[model samples]
Target: MTDRFSQASGTSAVGGVERRSTRSWSGVAWPTLGVGAILALVPLWLGDSRVMMGIAVLGLAFAAYTIAFNLIFGSTGQLFLCVGALAGIGGYGGAILADVVGLPIVVSIALSTSAAALAGGLLSWVAVRRSLGVIFTGIVTLIFALTFENLLLGLGELTGGESGFLMEAGRGTFLRSQIPPYYLMLGMVLLTLFVYGSLRRSRFGWAFRALRDDEVAAELAGIDVARYRIFAATIGAAILGLAGALLAFTEGRVSPTTFGFAEVDVVVLVMLAFGGIGSFLGPILGALTFTVIDELLVEVGQLRVFIYGALVIALFLWLPRGVVPALDDLLRRRRAGS
Candidate 1:
């Protein structure tokens, strides 16, 4: 893990440096890419396709989910709360189109992704028209999320209602073979990281940050706050939408339970909080740490739930910005003291 961090990132706090390094993109991305390359082969190394598949699917899906979440909530400071709903739109839309409408799986997923992006874009446009503030935006989106879930439940015949959507074995590309799904996941995650890294260093990212810091000041500086927010929402929602589509394959079905308030969105949000929101690799690290922690605690039964909750509280109390930021601060302080 240490080596992966060192090699993938050229950012440094050692030698009295207190900020990210001015490394080229390749240098900045090497560590993450290296780790991903190794992850790609874990199925062979672990000798248990099932175990490896579990790791890859869950980790990659949530990593993608959190990446989108980080872009809106963390980077741009838009409290866009309809993440799971948008993902569900993609998941259910894709599955129903594929299973019922008999569209090709790829086409279904593409349309579903587009639908999710359209939903996000519409929400952004509405929010801008209403001149909604952060809290109002969150409220409106949360309402949309709740409404979406109910919409699925209302369409009981189509969605399978309380029983959930049932996917037969060997249904989707993600289930064709464990290896294929894992590779797909690995590819998506790496691509997301690369895209995010590039975007973070681009003009869009700068505008996003400027909006995050001070909207009024950004507006004065000629930043079109409304336009960029919409861009973030559309792109981020599109990413989440794709993840949702992949998720249908991951679980072999679609369900409201899979994309509800206490499920997908909250999990991704917790991951972002634990990993240091807005930092490129923070949520990934957090996802890894918590997923392992959850797996380890499974044997402890219900006690693990309490433990997990306690840990989150502890994190907020002592390390509010998350593990990575705390470590960065510690390193900077030590260097200053020295």
Candidate 2:
């Protein structure tokens, strides 16, 4: 009787814990659903197709790039600046493979993404061999960006050099216009968010965080720091490559001018820093805010970049942890109060 009672009590406790977990998730879900509903209604309310499509496309692309950046920098604590170059490679490679080799867009995109992953792995291997800090990583990646740009510029036959190539309109009946592209981008963003969330909750995520926190200690704990770091870089690069391919398809063109190196790194860094580099939601928030600000300041001409730079500086000085962290803290406090 005692043993039976003990087992019953344990089962009851387990059930209670699960119920609490469900409630906690519901708390998060309701707010998310409410916000999503409001956003979804905006296009209908405004009835401006162009504005809606433009916002959707730009926001989605920015989010994709930011997520790729976060995979390495936020999770693995590695600073990299080659994302734009790799993305450009993916875009050009996909376009050429699809146009010249007669491969399907999907197949070409896969090939390009795979190539980018391999390149990223190789670069990570080289980077691991040296004890370069974040600044050094930025410098090395900047050199790579320059090299890639110059190489593409010289390869007039393949890349079309400065003139660029105009791809055939639409791949199939499914992806025809701005609306379709917007939906596709939304799907990719959701998929990436799911993948990232799962990854953060997995054992590999723990290993990554361990390495990020302290490489020496992680190594002592029998964690393969170098391998994990390389893995992060490779995966991050693949995402960037895929994002690039998507951008190419959306724009229906590939060009050297699209992947300029000068301010790419700064934009990425600012987004990551402003959104809170420690959380999954940081990149999304940062990307959306930055893209909106950028679009709003488009009319400012040359002064736009200066304004962005000032805002970044102000963010750093005032809220070093970024917006998401601050919001998260507030939420936690509210929950505690409730």
Candidate 3:
């Protein structure tokens, strides 16, 4: 009896060690290091300051927005279509607060983000109460977006209407300069990545995943399904608001045209789809790839959108799991063979 017990214990200990070693080797840290190294080398290879800076700023903004989308679509299994509209609300709100209310840019941003988050939370509450599916959610958000655009157009005095608000004294400083914006965006991206990483390791993340897999089962397992869903939406919206604020500051202006349905739909869907939607890196990969492609094809003018649409459709048809998952699978297979 003693010998049998000792043998079992010994096997368990050895298995545990092996498992830990394997996980340590195939960890996020190594992947993160590789990504960082690549980013650091980008400036050295890309001599065009304007292009590089534009890419960095746009990438960072889109990354934030995509991450926010992941919190709802990827994590909570909720499909939200108003992400762009919420961001526009944040942007316009910040601009108004700064320009009209005489608030500082930073304070205006904070206030604007908070307002958007609150609105998002309210929307989430409505969705959760009704148990709205993806289709309904999309419809609701689309209506909200159209309403916002029309409101902006009708209220020309406050929003500067169709002409848009121009930043006079606010423009041309280092705060508005390319390098400063790039560095600021980089810092924000790092912060967002850390926040998302930590969240995924938390109890909330587990609950969210469970809810995503089977909401009824998760509820039976003691998870508050509605609560988790609402929390996800609220958190996602807050991140979106922050991204919007950053974009507004970067552009030195806020305009209704910026939050149009077409742009919003293409960006949000492309980012989530191109990214694997399985891991934190998925959205990052999607955002970076989309931005690079868009920049490269911008010279093609009107043909660019058609090309992008075709590429996206092709990707969906050929690689449904997306670029990241396919590449990761290939890498894993190669490693296994080696």
Worst 10 residues of 2 by lDDT: 1-10
Kindly report which residue stretches of model 2 are placed more than 4 angstroms away from their true locations once superposed. Answer: 1-48, 169-173, 331-338
Candidate 3 ranges beyond 4 A from true positions: 1-48
lDDT of each: 0.75, 0.70, 0.72
Q: Write the per-residue lDDT of candidate 2 for residues 131-247, one digit (tens) a residue.
A: 576677768877888899898889889888887888773455455464666667666665665566556545666776676666778889999888887988898888778877887
Backbone clashes in each candidate structure, one number apiece?
3, 0, 0
Ranked candidates, highest lDDT first: 1, 3, 2
Residue 123 alpha-carbon offset, candidate 3, angstroms: 1.1
Query: What is every candidate's alpha-carbon RMSD to the true fold?
Result: 5.3, 9.0, 8.2
Q: Please give, for residues 1-338, the per-residue lDDT of candidate 1 as tens digits.
A: 11111221224321111145434566437756875977777778753667757666777788888888877677666678888899898889888888888887789889999999999989988888898877898999999999998888998999998767776533644465667777777777777777776777678767766676677888999999889888888888898898888778766878898888767776776777787766777777777667777778779998976876787777766666677656866887798899
lDDT of 2: 0.70
Looking at model 2, residue 54 earns an lDDT score of: 61
